[model samples]
Target: MPTTPRIADERHRYILEMLQEHGSCKVAELARTLAVSEMTIHRDLAHLARQNLLRKVHGGAVLRNYIELTFQDRAVQNHEAKVAVAQRAQSLVRPGTSLYLSPGSTTHEFALALIQDDLQIYTNSLPTATALARSAPQGLRVTLLGGELVVFVEALVGPATEAALADLRLTHAFIAVTGVSLEGGLTLYTEEEARVIRAVIRAARKTVLLTDASKFGQLVGPQVGHLEDVHVIVSDHIPDAYRQRCEQHDVEILLTADLDVMPTSAPGAAAADRRN
Candidate 1:
C-alpha cells in the first residue's frame, strides 16, 4: 500500500518520540499514528536505524543502545526550548565573567545567547567557539582547549584538553549532559568527555547544569558526577520528583522557559471569563 504524503523529517521525529515514550512501537501502530502505510513506517525505521538512533525489530522498532544524534541535528531538535534555557542561563552571566562552555547542543545555544564583552569564554566545542566569535557584542577573549578533536561530537577531549584547562579558573561552568538520574547522578555517554566536564566543574566556583525537560529521569551511560557536586540546574521543566531530589541535594532548580503561546482564540481569552 502507498504511504500518505507526509513531511519526511517530521515523520522521523514523531516516530522517534513514539518509540521513546512507549519503549517499543509496532509498525502497525506507528503507521496508524502517522497516518501512513506500514511500508512508509518501515522505511522510516530503516533510516533511523542507520543513524544508530534506533534498532529495527521483527514487528517494529525499539530504542538502540544510545541516542547518537549529531550536534547539528540535536541543536534544532528543540530549538526554542534551548533558546529559552539559554536566556535563563544568561541571567547568571555577568560582564567580565569567565565561562567554561562544555560540549553539547544546549551549551552551544548558550554560547549563542552570550552577548557580554570584556569576558573570557573557554570551550572545546567547535560550534561554541564559532558562535562566540560572531555574537559576543563586546571585545571578548576566547580560548580553545588543545586536544585531538572528536569529529562526531565536535569537541576536544582526551589528555591534551584536560591538561590545558588544569590551571584555568572559571566563574561558571555550564554543563550539558545526556541524562539525570537520582541514583546515577549526572551522566553522559563518553567517559573521556565526562572526565573533561568534571575537570571543568572543579575549576569553576559555581556549576549550573543546562538541560531540557526531556533529559529528566533518564539514566544512561557513565555517571559524570554526584548531584551535590552541582550548585544549580536550569531546565525547561523540573518535575516534582526532580524538584524533591534537587532540594535534597541542595541544588537550586530554575525553570525559565515559557511554553509556546498556542491560544485557541485571541490573546487574553482565559482571563476574559475569569472575573473576581
Candidate 2:
C-alpha cells in the first residue's frame, strides 16, 4: 500500500497529538507512522522542542509533563480549602471594577465565586472563562486573554498575553502561586507563567493572592516577585512564620474561617454548586 504524504505542519500536529496520548514518542516510530525519513522526524521534534512543546530525549521526544500536573489534576488537591479561600476572596472584590485572575485551581474557584455585577475580568484560564460565561451575572464582562496555550496548565501564555496586559490598569489582580514564603516569595512552576503573573501584579492597584495552606512554605520555580508585591493574602491557613512575615510587610491576611461567617453576595454560589 502506498503511504500518504503529510505536510510539515500536519506532521508536527500529529507528532504532538501522539506525544499527548502516549507521553513520549520514538523518532523511528514517528517516521514510520508519518511516512517520513528518520532525519525528517528528528527535525520535527527539534521544532516542537524550540516551541517548548516537548523535551527531546536520546532517540525520541516526550511531552513536558514533569513541569506541573494538568489543571484538572491539581484542581482536586485540597479542594475544600481552595473553596474556602475562594469564598473569602470573593468578599474583597467590589462590584463594577476591572480585575485580573491568574490561572490556577484556586483562581478557577475564585472565578466561580464572583457574583459582582458590572465587573470586568481578564484571565488566561480557559476553564475560568467558560465557567463565568455559563454562570456569571448578566452585567459581568470576562475577557479570555489571547496567547499561546500551555496544555498542562490549561492556560494561555507567552509574549502575546503580556502585550494584551501591557496597557490596561486593573483594580485588583487575584493571583495564585505554586509556592509562597518569605524567602521564595511568590514562585511558580514555569518562567512563562511567572512573566504573565508579574505583569498582572504590576497592572493592578492591589494584588490579592488566593492560596491555600499546602502552598505556604514550598519553593518551586522562579520567584514572580517579592512578598511585598502582594497587598492581601487570602488563605485557609497560614504558618506563623508567614503570618509574621505578612505583618512585617503590612500585608493584610484574611483567613477563610474568619471570613466564612460573612454572607456571600455572589450569585454564582448556587450555580457553582450545580456545576460541581
Candidate 3:
C-alpha cells in the first residue's frame, strides 16, 4: 500500500515525541517501532529536518536545539558542571529546613549531593525520590508527589500533583530548567511540567534555580516564571548579560567556581566580592 498522509503524519508525530523524550532516534529503531521500512523512516527524518523540527544525524535524528538531550544523556553531558552547581546549591540548604526539588538531571544530582540529615525534602521526580529514599540519612524525610507519571522526565505531574503541593509551605524550592533568558525567564519543554514547577515555586518561601552554562540566554519553551521569581541561581557560569539581568531582578547568581563563600544571609545581598 502507498504511504498515506495520515500514516505519515502519525509517524512524524511519534518521531518528534521520541526525539523530545529520548533526545534522538535511530532509523532502524524508529522503523521497527512504526512497522515501516528503514526507507520510510529516512524519509520521515528528512522531512522533519527540513521543517526545522529536528536535525538529521548519521543514522538518527535529534531535537531542533541539538542540545536538548534526554535526561540520561544530559546527566552525563555536563557531569562536572552539574556536580559543581549541586555542591554550591547544597550550601544553601540549612539543617532542619524543608525544601522541594523540581525534576531534571541537575536536580537529581542535587538530590544525591545532599548530606543534610535533619531536613525535609519533597519531590515530583521518581528517580530523585528513590535516590533520597535509598540513601538519605535518618533525619531526612522524603515525600513524593502523587499524580500522573511522565516517564520521559521520570516525574509526576498534572492537577493531582499540583494539589498535593497546595497546602504545604517549604523553606526552599530547588528547580531546574530547560532554558533561561532575560526575556523568557525559566522555560521547560511542556506546560504540564511548567505548571507543576510554578506550584513548587509558590509553595516555597524561596526559589533556587539549578542550571549549567548551556541553559543561559536561551528560550526553550513555555515560560515558568521570570528571573525575579527566583531568589538564587546556582550555575557553572553566568553570562555577562545575565549578570546585569540578575542584578536588576535582585536575583543572586552563585557560581560553582566560588563555592568557597557561603550564600549571603539575604538573597541578592552577596558580599562585594560575589556581586556581579
Candidate 4:
C-alpha cells in the first residue's frame, strides 16, 4: 500500500494521464477505476486543477487545448529567471496588506515569496493558495475564490469566481501575462484566464505586471488590458524602444540590470538592441 502522501501524488499523476489519453473523465468513474474513494478523487482533481493540468467539470475533467505545455514542461523553463522575478515582486509587498495573485509560473514564484509575511491573499490560483496555506505565516489569511477549476493553470475562473471577487478589495495585484505587445497591450492564451486577470486588476489598488524578457512582443491571444492599466512593469530587461513605449503610457519600467550607462533617448535604438 502506498503512503498517504505518495498515494495522493500518484492519484494526481493518474488523473493527468487520464485527461491526456482520453481528453476527459468522470469523477465517479475515475474513483472506481483507480480504486480510491470519491472524496479522494475529488481532492486529487482539485490538486491537479491547481497546477493548471485540467479543468474540472460537472462530473469529471477536461484538458485545456489552448494551453500548450503540460505541468511538467513548465517546471523546467527559465527556473532561475523566474526566481529572480519572484524575488523582485516580493519586495513590493508590505507586511499586512491584502494581495491578489493571478495564475502563472512567475506569479506562483511571487506567492512562494510571501511565505513569511502576515497578510491576506485572495486568489483563483489553487497552487498559489496551497503554497501560501502550507508555508505562509500562521497569522496570514488565504482565500481561494470559487469558480471552475482550470487544470492547465491550477486557477479558478468563471462567473462564480468573478462574482466572489466583486466584494473584495486588494492592496496589490501581481499579474503574470503570457505576452506583452507594444501595441496590442497585455495578452494571454485563454479568454477565461484573461477575464479572471482583468478582475484582479480591477480589484487591486496597485497592479504590477510581472514577466520575463521573453514574454515581450510575443502575442498569444487577445489583449487583456493596455499598458495604462498597470502601475509598474517588472522584467529582466526591457529594450529601449519597449521601455519608451511603456513610459509613454505612464507605466514605470524596472529592469534587473543597467543595460548601458548612457541611455539613448531613442526608443527605436532600444528596439535595435535585440540580438535576433
Candidate 5:
C-alpha cells in the first residue's frame, strides 16, 4: 500500500471513474485494482463518501443505486425493515388527506401499506403510483406527476414535476432517501431526485422520512433538506448520533421496531400505529 496526497487524489478519481463505468465496485476488487490493501480502499471510500462523490454500501461503494432500480431488487434488499418503516409511516395518512411520496423502494411499499380511503396521493415514482392504484382503498385518488422518467429509476423528474408540486398543498410529505447525516441532512443519490424531494417537502405542511438503518449516518449525492425540515423520521433503528441530532432539532423519531414513539415534538399532532 502506498500513501501520498497525490496518490490518494488519483485513487479517488479512479474510483469515481470506475463507478461511472461499472455502476459499483467491491472493496476487495477496488483494493486489487488499485494495488492497495483493503484498508486503503476503505479509507478511500470514507474520503469519497464524505465528499459526496459516492454512496458507501456494505462491502463496497456505488455510483447510484437508483440506476439499477427494480421492484425485485429493491423490494427485497431490506424487505423486513422497509416494511416495518412503511407500516409505521402509514399512520401519517388519514382519509381525505393529501400526501407527497417521492421515489424510493420504501416509499413504494409505503404506498402499499396505506389503507385509508379518499386520500389524494401525489408522487413521481412509477411503481408507487401503480402500487397505490391497484390496492387503493375506495375513494383513494392517485396523481402521477408528469415528467420525463429517469432511466432505470422509473421515476419522473424535470420541470413539469416541480411545477406540479408548486401548485399543490399537502397534509404530509413522506419521502425516502439514500442518506441522512447531521452534516448533509437528507440526501438522495442524484441532484435531480434531491430537487424533486425538496419540492415535495415544500408543498406539504409536514415532512416524514422513511429509511432503514443503513441510511442513518450515510452521505450521498445531494441533500433535500436539513434535519429541522423533517417532522418525523421512521426507520428500523435510529443511530444514537442521529437520535441526538434529531432531539436537538426537535425532530421526532419513530422506531419501526415498536412503533410506539410519535413525532410529539413537531408542531402538529404526533401519530403512529402501536406494536408490541
Candidate 6:
C-alpha cells in the first residue's frame, strides 16, 4: 500500500493524465479505481482546477483545451526566465495598493509574489485568484469577477466579466500576452481574453506588461492594446531595436537585468529586481 502522501500525489497525477487522455472522468469511478475516498478525489480535483490544470464539471473534471501547452509541459519551458520576469513585475506593487492581474503563466508568477502584501486585487483568472486566496499576505483583499468560466485557460471572460470590470478602478494593471510585436502591438490567443485585458488597461492608472524575452517580435493574434497605452514594459530583456521602437511610442521600457539587487534569492531574482 502507498503511504498517504504518496497515494494522494499519485492520485492527483493520475487524474491530470486521465483528463489529458480521456478528456474527462467521473469522480466516483476515479475514486473506486484508485481505492480512495470520494472526498479525497474531490480535494485533488479542486487543487488541479485551481492550478488551471483541469475544470470541474457536473460529475468530474474535464481537460481545458484552450491552454496552448499542457500544465506539465509548461513547467519546464523557460521557467527560470519567467520567474525572473515575474520578480521584476513584483517590485512595482506597493503595499496597501490595489491592482489588476491578467491570465498567463508570467502574470500568475507575478500574482504569487504579491501574496505577501496587503493588496486589493481584481482579476478574471481563476488560477491567480486561487493562488492569492491560498497564500495571500495578511489583510489582502481579492475580488474575482463573475462570468462564464473558460475551463481551458481558467480565465473569466465574455460580456458578464467585462461588465463587472467596467465598474471598478485600479491603481495598476499587470498584463501578460502571447506576443509583443514592435509593429503589431500586444497580441493574445483569444479575442475575448484580449477584450477583458483592454478593459483592464483602460481602468487602471498604470499599465505594466510582464513578458519574457522570447515573446518579443512575435505576433499571436489580434491586438489587445498598444505600447502607447502602457506606462512601462517590464521584461527580462528588450533588444536595442525593440527598445527604440517602444520609445517611439512614448513607452518607458524597464529591463530586468538593469534593476537593483533583490531581497529574495529566487532563481528569477534578476528580472524581479528591476521593478522598482
TM-score of each: 0.69, 0.70, 0.72, 0.67, 0.73, 0.67
Candidate 4 at 34: error in angstroms?
53
Order by lDDT, highest first: 3, 2, 5, 1, 6, 4
The digit string of per-residue lDDT tens for model 5 on 44-66 reads 99998887777786677766534
lDDT comparing candidate 1 with the true structure? 0.76
Tens digits of per-residue lDDT for model 6, 34-147: 988788788888988898877776567765555465333554678888888888777677887789988888878887876456789998888889989888888999999888
| lDDT per residue (tens digit) for residues 31-52 in model 1 | 8987878988899999999998
Global CA lDDT computed for model 3: 0.81
Candidate 1 regions exceeding 4 Å error are: 1-64, 257-276
Model 2 worst lDDT window (10 residues): 267-276
Candidate 6 stretches greater than 4 Å from native: 1-67, 70-75, 260-276
- Cα lDDT of model 3 by residue, 1-276, tens digit: 889999999999998887665555679889898899999999999999889998776667656773445677767978889988998888888998989999899999999999889898899999899889898988898889899987778889999999989888888889999888776578776667888998888788878899999988676655688877888888988888888776675677789888454343454354222321
Give lDDT: candidate 2, residue 61.
Answer: 72
Q: How large is the C-alpha RMSD of every model relative to the true structure? A: 14.4, 13.3, 10.1, 14.4, 9.5, 15.8
Q: All candidates' lDDT scores?
A: 0.76, 0.80, 0.81, 0.73, 0.78, 0.74
Candidates 2 and 5, the one with greater lDDT: 2
Worst 10 residues of 3 by lDDT: 267-276
Error of 6 at 35 (Å): 66
Between 1 and 6, whose lDDT is larger? Answer: 1
Backbone-clash count (model 6): 5
For residues 15-130, write the lDDT of model 2, one tens digit per residue. Answer: 88876554556788888987778998888889889999887766677566455778999999999999999988888788878999999999999989887898999999998999
Per-residue accuracy of model 4 over 27-86 as CA lDDT, tens digit each: 898889989888778888888788877767666666655455643466467777877777
